[model samples]
Target: MPNIEQFTPTEAYEALREDETAALVDVRSRAEWTFVGLPDLAELGRDTILAEWRQFPGMTPNPSFLDDMTRQMGGTTPQTVLFICRSGARSQDAAIAVSQLMEEAGTPIRCINVAEGFEGDLDGSGKRGGLNGWKAANLPWKQS
Candidate 1:
């Protein structure tokens, strides 16, 4: 079994900025990406890959997640891929799946989950973004 690594949003951002072969994959739904905003990697000279881990509405798992990820790679395999979602759970699942697929393909890429994700966990007030997450950490992001 392949092991999945974890990184905080800030750490992931730093790693992506420092490593030329590293990429960030946002596994959130299309709706989330449009409404909740997205992590901006423009300054790093890299675009964040948008791949849905789950469909919107019912939140069903996306059947083409792996294929979508492959297509997003654009024929270039990254040495490291960091997955992020609304929170860490979905990204962890994405990381595990990608890790297994990469291992099977003998590519052995490092699949990392962005802990705290984009929105982080719900605070005592039952709201996100207030807790520790990419947005809360004051990282650059933009809405579309």
Candidate 2:
């Protein structure tokens, strides 16, 4: 019965620093990662995870999301698979999907959904990344 945890950017960074085998999966779309940016988990000396959702524009749950996650996991053993998205919604879904996959395979991997994603809450102009996300936490990140 593996459960999920909510990790702040700083805590997540610290975990990555201590464990080289840990992975941070950015469930954000390619566009968001390109335009907004992503946390520099690699610079902190951990294996940065990558499994971008396969869709466009809106953050809709892809029916094959779990399949893709299984592919990404491949033969790797169950480790920390942190999921992050624009505002944490999609990441939660992703985490649940991944966790279910792991359970089905009897791996029981630990997965977490970042409470606030790359972009936090909506700003005055209804924008994100200004209130409570990775950017707001002042975590190391770079635009791609």
Backbone clash count for every predicted candidate, in the order shown? 0, 1
Q: TM-score of model 1 relative to the true fold?
A: 0.96
Q: Estimate each model's TM-score.
A: 0.96, 0.83
Model 1 CA deviation exceeding 4 Å by range: none
How big is the RMSD of model 2? 2.5
Residues 1-144, candidate 1: write the lDDT tens digits: 667788899999999989977989999999999999999999998788998999998899999988887787896778899999988999999898888878888888888899899999999999999788999999999999
Worst 10 residues of 2 by lDDT: 45-54
Error of 2 at 7 (Å): 1.4
lDDT of 2 by residue, 5-118 (tens): 988776777777777667788887778778888788657664445666657676565676665555666747547778888788888877887888778988887787788888
Q: What is the C-alpha lDDT of each candidate?
A: 0.90, 0.75
